[model samples]
Target: MEEILQLLSEDARLTDAQIAERTGISEAEAKDAVAKLEKDKVIRRYKTVIDWERAGIEHVFGFIEVRCAPERGVGFDAVAERIMEFPEVHSLYLMSGAYDFLVVIQGGNMRDVAYFVAEKLAPLDHVVGTATHFVLRRYKVDGDVMVERAQAKRLPVTP
Candidate 1:
């Protein structure tokens, strides 16, 4: 299972036959293992990581640190749910600090981002205030270079 998972993590697009061939398992066993992993919620999702900026997204992406009221009982989760519903929000996390949540958002310009904050996020019930800082640049992403290097290494097997 660990070997199968390693192969999938390196590239989830591998066929059962390929996985089995690499992992030294029968093709049918590879299929069953993948199915069971999905059923057991071990493999929750397979997602594509896109370079949105290179894909012609011109504006800056920013992280907003929000201070919200804990009186809402569910704390930041309720507010986060509302925030995530917006298309502009790429990601949100409940943080442990002076701020309750960290939100990642993207927009075409500063004006668009401002509007999203003022019109949508700020209006949420427990939200107190928000501090936003735009990302100037990204040196690395999702450890792509590391993954590419790992992929380049030949799998150890007697084929």
Candidate 2:
């Protein structure tokens, strides 16, 4: 099962037959395992990591470090859920250190992201403070390098 998951994680498009061939298992077994995983909600969804900049889309991505006061009865989960309900929030994570939640959001531009922070995020009851950092470039995402730097050209040494 672990082997099957590892293979799928590397390339989600791999068919069960391909997985069976690679793992030396029966095709039926491979298919059953994958189906079980999906049924049990272990496999959430397959995703394609795209280099959006190359596609000529103008997007602004920001990482917000949020400091919040946890609610009395529900704790951080309540605040986290409220933040997650917003469409602009792509991902949210509980973190260690200075911030309670690390939020990733996308918008048309910097001003749009700022507007979201000011209008939507800040008004939340538990939200204490937020620090937003705009992404200048995405060199790598999900272990895939988006940009490859060119090699420097050098003159041959004459000696």
Candidate 3:
């Protein structure tokens, strides 16, 4: 089961036969396992990572460190649920250290991201403060290197 999960995580495009062959299991068994995993909500969704720079699409990614007051009894759950409803919020995590929540957002430009922090996220109930950082470039994402290595160029030697 773990092997199947690992295989699927590495490459979502793998067929049941491919996974079964690699794991030394029957193809039908692999299919059953995957079906069970989906039913149990273990396998959330398959994803594709794209290079927006190469695609010529402009987007700004922002990481916001949020300081907030946790609600009584519910703690951060209530606040997290509220933040999740925003379309601009790509991801939100309850964090430790100086901040209570780390919010990842995407927008067309820096001003768009700034506006979300200043108007939407920061003004939320229980939200005390927020510090935003823009991602200049992504060298790696999800263990996959974003930058492709270039071939070394050598100058011609004079005889």
Candidate 4:
């Protein structure tokens, strides 16, 4: 299962037959394992990490460090649910540091993200303060390089 998970994690496009070939398992077993994983809620969603900039799609990302006051019974889960409900929120995490929640937001522009933080996020019931960092450029995302690295040209060899 771990082997199947690792392979799927690296490349979600891998078919059961491919997984079987790599993991030295029978195709039927591989299919059953993958099916069980999905049914068990282990494999949640398959995603494609796209280079949106190269695709000519203009967008902006903001990393927001949110300071919050947790609800007595729920801790941060209550506020987390609210924050995650927003369409702009790409990802959210409960952190252990100066900030309580680390929120990643994607928007059409810097102003749009700023509007979301200032107008929407800051006004939330338990939210105390926020520090937002706008992404200038994306070198890599999800372990995949966004830009192609320049290859070194070989010098002419004389015999």
Assess each prediction's global lDDT (C-alpha) against the native. Answer: 0.82, 0.93, 0.90, 0.92
Single out the weakest 10-residue window by summed lDDT for candidate 4.
Answer: 49-58
State the weakest 10-residue window (summed lDDT) of model 1. 143-152
- TM-score of candidate 1 on Cα atoms, chains taken together: 0.77
- Name the 10 consecutive residues with the lowest summed lDDT in model 3: 106-115
Models sorted by lDDT, best on top: 2, 4, 3, 1
The deviation in Å at residue 132 for candidate 4 is 1.0
**Against the correct fold, how does model 4 do in TM-score?**
0.87
User: Tens digit of lDDT per residue, candidate 1, span 11-71?
Assistant: 9899999998998899999999999999999999888756666777776688998888865
Work out the TM-score per prediction.
0.77, 0.87, 0.88, 0.87
Top model by TM-score, which number? 3
For candidate 1, list the clashing residue pairs, or say none. none
Assess the local accuracy of residue 97 in candidate 2 as a C-alpha lDDT between 0 and 100. Answer: 98
What C-alpha RMSD separates each model from the true structure? 5.0, 5.2, 5.1, 3.3
What is model 1's C-alpha RMSD? 5.0
Model 3 RMSD to the real structure? 5.1
